[model samples]
Target chain A: MASKFETPQVRKFPIIPKLENSATSHLSPFKSKEEFQSSLGYPGELVENWQEKAIDKMGDLLGKYRSLRVYLDSCIQCGACTDKCHYYQGTKDPNNMPVGRQNLMRSVYRRYFTLPGKYFPKLVGAKDLTKEVLDDWYSYYHQCSQCRRCAVFCPIGIDTAEISMAAREVMDSIGVGQKYCNEIIGKVHKIGNNLGLPEPALADTLEGLEEDVLDDTEIDVKFPLDVKDSEVLLVTPSADFFAEPHVDGLIGYAKVFHQAGISWTLSSHASEAANFGMFIGSYDNMKKLAMRIREAALELNVKRIVFGECGHAWRVAYSFLNTLAGPFDFLDPRYPVPQHICEITNGLIDQNVLNFDKSANDDMTLTYHDSCNVARASSMGGIMGGQFTIPRKIIQTVANNFYDMDDETIKEKTYCCGGGGGLLTDDLMELRVKGALPRMEALKHLIEEKGVTHMAAICAICKSQFSKVFQYYDLELDQIVSLHQLVSNALIMNKKEV
Target chain B: MSFVTILYAAMFYFAAAILFIGLAYRVYEYAKIPAPLKIPTPPAPMTQKGVAIRIFREVVFFESLFSATKWTWLFSWIFHLALLLAAFRHLKYFTDPVWFWVSFELVQVAGHYAAYLMLAGLLGLLARRVFVDRVRYISSPSDYLILVLIIAIAGSGLMMKWFPSDILAIKLFFVGLLTFNFSELPSDVVLLIHLSLVIALMIIFPYSKLLHAPGLFFSPTRNQVDNARSKRHVANWAKRMESTK
Candidate 1:
């Protein structure tokens, strides 16, 4: 797992290397327990005749999800996506390649479903659903960040992310699930958030945040929780409650809400925005998790809903929430069903309602890293390219020096932070570090050439990922800053009097 | 009626039947499958008209491949475009007096160059699979064989064009077959080989990776609009779940 190739001093595109055997086969996440698996409606253990069950599930999925069937049948192996994956680029493993990873399940799909593969498996590169094949699927599929980078470049739009998701769903149905995602999902079901920070702890955290904001500025900005009849219910990731930089972003949201005189409260029932069900590819689980927001909104009678900084969460909310828990007729129809906090702040900025003393961020030169989910899965301002522009617009408005990385590495072409798609656990540390190579290389270029002292990201996962993986490249952990943290630093609270 | 003509007429009919029926079944399967969620790669088009234009650009221009790697795109585009021209030009054999468009001098000239380009493009693509480390690693035997098969078909066709085989007999044979009358077929070795290879490609089209032709149109991630928030997209099974709830 060591850096097999020379670390490029500046960011460059990943070149195809000679394929190595077992480059990452040793990497696998801890398996979930029986209770954890059953909690999410999966089997307690590997079921009897799991092969048949897995194949049946694959067939069920093929019927239920059109993307799976199309993608499975469509690949011509032209290798357009061969070098598109960050893990393959970093690991030099053919299995990490998008097509290679997909074939882990695609091969079995071929064997059981296609006539040629059923008759002549070896000729078609198809294999039976053996235990070894299942283990490989678990390993390689987890390595993918579900970023859809390869899907963008594929001629037929064969998304490996869809294949990975289907494979995970199949595994879970067979009583094989990743401990990190399944356990977190169980926590969300039992308690309200992944952290299991109960109502008292959440109240305690908000109290500390409110005191901190007042200590910094004379104005007492409120961080309300479970307050009924609030105009807006803010749903943010639990990491923002405790983690540095993320916590600063949380405080920034509070100040923005205070300055705008908007009554917003966080729902303890739906305290966290991150949805691990999306990572594990379970629609039932994802929908169950998403339904909490709708329930909380109706119960609290909030007119609107606004989501905080979380990558995949925003994707689920922006792209899947309406279908999962819809008919939000009780809420305000004037706003976007669930507006992104960036859009809210940007709207306020556009209205000249919020003031920023840009010089407050003079200590830093910054570049924005677009989270994969936000960059590719959802948009802001209901326009194309809004996702890419809205965050950078906010950053430039708040900070003095903002330079973008190479065009190829930004916007829709952005690399995953490597810790996404539920691979953020310590069990997959090597994959996380190596997978961070592409984005890290981009950051290194900005640091050396553009005087980019810090990189701001909207997602909590990207912030946590860069903070941990920066050490491997001899970069400081503090180099990863939150976009709202920058906004927090620059906002002039006393501007209303001026 | 010659024995060779009868044999070829029957072969073409069988191959065409398999190709059409098989492709139709596969396409129906793809179309019937429910897309439970909205997952279009963004910045996706918002309207149905926009998505159609997007797919048209992808099919005609290979836009995604053009952005991915210029080398693959160049070879793939040349092969596909030239293949289209070469196939269209060959329509003269099945039509009596030929379609008016095929009679154009420009079309005739383009067809000749297209055949040459097709051969050149196939060879370049085959070379990439052979030499490129990443491509070579992922290439199965069928992948390489598919390329070799196409190269053979193109090579044989080019030989007949350059050597001036019994074109009148070949055209009469195809035209007679279409009209349910048999004619003496060309016994020229190159023409026979070319016809056999073309028949094989058609028979194998639906069963093999050639399904990508239809699969591209059905791909949900590429074809769906990025308007999940504005309009709810619930699949049939998802609707059933709601009803049960």
Candidate 2:
């Protein structure tokens, strides 16, 4: 289907686009309906005293989160982060610029919370919390993917993600929640996962997966669900249970587990690893979601908890899990509380437990797209930049030809997949396609220069996003492959016992 | 004491009070609020010592800014380094027995020339705010005025070298203020203008974006240690929520 919005032309060399005033001002996500809003404990709709409530929420968040308070106060308007955002680069809307998006709420913050802004608002660029300003917050703040690429470049480490998240939180508190994030969060609360897959349905999906693997690999690689006394509890995103390319990665996890001879089971209780609560900046909801995993781990008596392939899921698992639902003194203390699947696969590859037939992936020359959250927000193997190396190591072991994209576009400087931090819904398809411009340009460069056909990603969002966006850029949809799907292809599941 | 002496002394005292007290309050608020999550921008250091080194590199070298854009880093670094040197040189006036380093010939010569570099840095910053479309779009009136204010201060200070002021009386006046002894301040127009702008910067330091200096130390993204997995980080507010669970 042709995109309703114009797709940004892939540039040969990336240049900062000229600022267009309100270029994407009309692209706000659908607001949460009454049921969706209240299910997450927010008001049903725009509250009667939303203005006062929003300012009060802002004041409360400023006190509660040091990141929100310090970041709002610390921006020097230096523009180091201006061209750093994919949204800004694609849309050319000044408001999509990290500083511009921040100034939306920062202006309000100054007006209500600072002394000078209280007296001389215009001089300091502070504005009253008017309807127009609040609308700008909703439209522009959603445009941000909370990627933190801007933070890596900021002089004072002023994270625009923190600002946008707080803006979202303040909006939700005043009954102005976005439908996509709020509804997903509500599903995770009521049902076990974002897709609202019930326990029996989850088991049925796993069973179908087991049969599919048996039909292909002719091995009894078990995709266990709710099996007590298992050695490991695998809490993957619900999308992995059914979505294309993601489900293949799930099969790869089963194959690896079978080969390594480590027993693992999925939890019907804490079925989701992608916590939308973090996207909305609700600590309460985030902790509640995190605690479900903790409860599952304790109830199943698992020795280790390993998260599957998801970007922000791994971030929450790697970074915030311990803080949110920790002292997992109950689980084995030797392992990291929640380890990443790539770390496990890489470890097995190092130990020579899982042998790979490198020629199995010889049909395509491959490149890796570092998902923004996993690359920048979280780490692997308890070492700096391990998140980058560990995944590449796994791919290199499994594939004969593996290449990386542009240096600046890969490691800690990696661009967002345009669908992360809950901006992946179909309603925001235009924003997603436009936001993918920077990443697409880099991928286009590799495809032309290096004969790269497939771009592998560990993030479910990245995979799904690329699958949709590749067609827009005239690349094949199948060009986007799961990192573990490559593993599934190359792994010698039935090696001769020698 | 002449009226100029008492008026300047009172102004100095008030400015000093605002700078210190206001800074303390802002710092206190930052320190009091707990960072509930571990959100260091990676590849961040994994230990406390490594995090200290990370923050030190950020502050002393403007490492992240350098990685971002060379132009911003060059202007900002030169401006900050020159400001520090000039502040160090001013210590000679305030101290009764100037420290050996402050009295050193190299310090005196370098400090005098630091004003030119300071002005150059500020001008470069101001030029960006005006010329760069991205920077100009974000630049508020106060952002421009702050740069201009500092430029004027440095310009007026540099002017005193050619249109000379009473250096000896200025030193004695500052020393007298320190020792609680009233003395006359030379009412040089340039010196008065310079001092007035300096006082204005001090009064606005805590309230303005000037807080980015001390605020950098409190930034959770820069200051946080990347040991969230190994060590469970819990804040007081979060702890209450956990207890209810």
Which candidate achieves the best TM-score against the true structure?
2
Q: Candidate 2 lDDT, tens digit per residue, B203-229?
A: 999999998988899998889888989
User: Stretches of candidate 1 above 4 Å error?
Assistant: A1-14, A495-498, B162-165, B243-245
- Checking candidate 1 for backbone clashes, the offending pairs are none
Full-model lDDT for every candidate: 0.89, 0.91
Which DockQ-derived CAPRI band holds candidate 1?
A: high
Please, what is the TM-score per model?
A: 0.97, 0.99
B49-134, model 1: which lDDT tens digit per residue? Answer: 98999999999999999999898899989999999988778887888989999978887778878988998888889999999887
Q: Which candidate is the best by lDDT?
A: 2
Most accurate candidate by DockQ: 2
